[model samples]
Structures are given as structure tokens and as C-alpha cells.
Target: MIETLAKLVSTKIKTGVTQKELGARINMKQPQIAKIERMHTLPSFSTLTRYAAALDLSIKMTVESIIK
Candidate 1:
């Protein structure tokens, strides 16, 4: 899940928004964005929402029972 989130962030960043710019939009810093993008850190739910908003994206979560 974290890896997928990281990939999502990377894809958004590749859409012409630099880490620094995205961070500025989210009131964070480039290093923090880098850490999240590199999967070195996992952001909280609120932070994740902020990232999505900054990139004009949305998050959708689904859960399934593994025991099924």
C-alpha cells in the first residue's frame, strides 16, 4: 500500500509539479516530500489527503476480507 502511494505521488510530481512546489502547496518541505515519495516515510491520513488535494487528485480506499 505504501509502495502504491509512493508511486501515485511520483506520478503526480511527474506531471510538472516539483517536490518543492507541491510541498509549498501543502505547507511542507521538499525533503519531506522526497521522503514520502521514496517510501522512506508513510504519511498520516490527513497528510495523504493534503497531498492528493495539492495534486488535484483524490484517494479511494477499499478493503477486502483475506479470510474469504
Candidate 2:
């Protein structure tokens, strides 16, 4: 989960959006965004949503049972 989140953030950052700009949109600091992108910390669900929004992305979650 953490790796996936980091990849998503990195992809967004590659699209010409600086971490500082993204943080400004989400009311966070660049270091906080860096931590998230580096997988140094995991954000809460709400914070994840805010990150997605700031990156002009949306998150979709689905649950499946391991047992058939």
C-alpha cells in the first residue's frame, strides 16, 4: 500500500507539479509531501484523499474476499 501510494505521488510529480505546489493545494508542507512520496510515512484516509485531489486524481477502492 505504501509503495503504491508513493508511486502514484511520484507519477503526479513527474507531470510538472512540484511537491511544494501540491502541498500548497492540500494545505501541507513540501516536507510532508516528500515524506509521503518517499514512503517515510503513511497518511490517514482523509489525507490520502486530499493528496489525490491536489494532484487532480481520484481514488477508487474495492474489497474482495480471499476465499471463494
Candidate 3:
């Protein structure tokens, strides 16, 4: 799930924004953003929310019932 979210963020960043630009928006370093985009490090929930907000996006989560 995290990997998927990372991929989505990466793709959106590539669309019209650079990593450095995004980092600045989120008060993070470019390398750190790169690490997150590449999935080298998993971003904390707070960081994820910040990232999404930086891109004017939102994060949504869904839960599935295995018992079903």
C-alpha cells in the first residue's frame, strides 16, 4: 500500500513539478524527497499528509474485511 502511494506521489511530482520544488514546498530536502519517491524510505503518516498537501492532493484509505 505504501509502495503504491509512493508511486502515485512520484508520478504526480514528475507531471509538472521537480523534486527540489516539492521539497521546498514541504520544507524537506530534495534528496529526502527522492528517497521517499524511490521507496528507499517509508514516509511517516505526517510526512505523507504533508506531501499530499504540497501537491494539492489528498490521501484516502480503505479497509477490507478479510472475514468477508
RMSD for all candidates, in order, please.
Answer: 1.8, 1.5, 1.9
Name the candidate that leads on TM-score.
2
Question: How many Å off is the CA of 35 in candidate 3?
Answer: 0.6
- Cα lDDT of candidate 2 equals 0.81
TM-score of each: 0.78, 0.83, 0.78
Model 2, span 15-67: residue lDDT tens: 88888988899999999988977778878878888888777787778899999
lDDT of each prediction vs. the true structure?
Answer: 0.83, 0.81, 0.80
Off by over 4 Å in 1: none
Residues 13-65 of candidate 1: C-alpha lDDT, one tens digit per residue? 58988889989999999999899887788788788888888878777788889
TM-score, model 1 to reference: 0.78
Give a tens-digit lDDT track for model 3, residues 1-68.
Answer: 57656665776657788889889999999999889877798888888888888877777778899995
Q: At residue 25, what lDDT does model 1 achieve?
A: 94
lDDT of 3: 0.80
Q: Show the colliding residue pairs in model 3.
A: none
Best by lDDT: 1
